[model samples]
Target: MQPLSHLESFVRSAESGSFSAAARQLGLTPAAVSKNVARLEAGLGLRLFQRSTRKLVLTEGGERLLQQISGALGTLSDAVAGAAEAGRQPAGTLKVSMGQAFGREYMVPLLSDFLARYPAILPDWHFDNRQVDLIGEGFDAAIGGGIQLTPGLVARELGRVHVVAVAAPGYFGGRAAPTHPSALAGFDSIVRRSSPTGRLRTWTLRGPAGEEAAVEGRPRMILSDPEAMCRAAAMGLGIALVPMPFALPALQAGALARVLPGWYADAGPLSLYYPSKKLLPAKTRVFVDFVVDQFHARGFAERMSGAGEPVA
Candidate 1:
């Protein structure tokens, strides 16, 4: 591999648009910047910049190289910062913005465990379902899972959240079992105001033809949150398509029954997102690490249900 020193200097020069400016910004002499770029071009066997008396322009080759170089340098920078921050065990307040149901169901238990482990750290938690502006709201991190991701934030995948279509035993007491997702149209359903999936978002099932199956249902009870959906299904009001974490407790208590376990949709991953910055303070890093380590991708559903799942 070519030396990163030369590649970093090359990227800095391209971004700054001049050797002198890049040198001044990086605390190196103009000649050093020129030499680094020359070394980089030699390593790649390509000319990067067209240098004139008054202006510097990147060659086509330089533009392509800059794309890869910038990302590499940025990753290296973050790695360095992470290493430096790890030495310190941070103490202070960490503000978390999360969905109301998720906050109550999972984060509360997770936070209790964290607080017990690190008594010095006190986190202020806020629960809301709408999109939140992390910088505007003064939030250090957000625990949100869905396909929609906020631009300019770094999102780390926690795990896939499984969704199950459920109803009370009495609701389907006399009716024949629904064989397909479309069959749910014949039954009442609880729907939230919004869905993670759009029109195409439906339960994916393997059909008789060995092809994938999808079905759409009309909402009998349009609810605002997962709790309402779960309750409606438990009360034998309708079939509710809800996340596994939300229905797990009731399923174990025998209050709710899984309608079609083999035909439920697999929702996407739950993620912890934060800002990608030069210095993620010690408290934020520790919280991120602690929560990620705690989740480890598998135990969240089991933990939420109060079931003992094998450790991931």
Candidate 2:
């Protein structure tokens, strides 16, 4: 009989789109990952991945098998870790997915304390600018701003994410600042694909009469990374509606100035979400409890913000 380890490796390699990346994630050598995948394929007598020198493409069969195995694999992993470390500590890996911009600015640094406190639990992190399917790809948890929760999953809100509409000092020198949301059409703006919304984002606010101020204009630059958009806004490329935390340091340094402060829309909440389970296995329970405790005790809602009324 094929072991769960072989099946899990094959699924991760396929989902990650490469052996090397999956190997790095699973804390195994590339050769080890390759051998395990080969073992699984040989046992089934089926070719799961169509491999090239540059990449691995999943076969149709691989996709179906991934569906069958992913849920079971998660359960098995939770089960084994549960059985082995019952009273000692939560051991084994927790897969965490997140975006590039805020991950660098916040989550990465915050995780150091988490790791130190829970030495038995290891986090296998996937950082990307693109939104991933949590259920299909099998991430244990993801911390990000602007996540829209799907049904049957649980989204634990950390706090409100503040945003600022900003431009370079030179860009606004002689020009009138946008006092009304309708005035935004006159400026060159930068647009970013919001990972939380899974849409080409637009800036919106409530006008004086409680009307939705739809700020639409041609973007001088379009980017997926929030950090890039913040940098571009500071360099005078165009106006950028950026998360306050991403721009907070620069704003403090006087490198960027807030434009249309009254009309700026608050960012969606930062959250750590997971697939809700009946058992809430020991590892998930411990981590979730720890995270909730960490934030609630430290007043995360007040901290992830820059300034202004509470958006949540």
lDDT (CA) per prediction: 0.73, 0.74
- Candidate 1 weakest lDDT stretch, 10 residues: 303-312
* Prediction 2 TM-score vs. true: 0.64
Q: Return the clash pairs for model 2, or none.
A: 146-196
Tens digit per residue, CA lDDT, model 2, 1-312 = 788779878977876777777776567877888899999999999989999998888899888888888777868776785677667766668887877766675567668787787787887888886566665455777877556677436888887776667777678778788877678788998988855565788767654355667778667777877788888988989988877767766776677777765555666787888876544556567777777777787676775554543232
Pairs of residues clashing in candidate 1: none
lDDT of 2 at 128: 81
Runs in model 1 deviating more than 4 A are: 1-88, 147-152, 195-210, 301-312
Deviation in angstroms for 216 in model 1?
A: 3.3
In candidate 1, position 142 carries an lDDT of 90
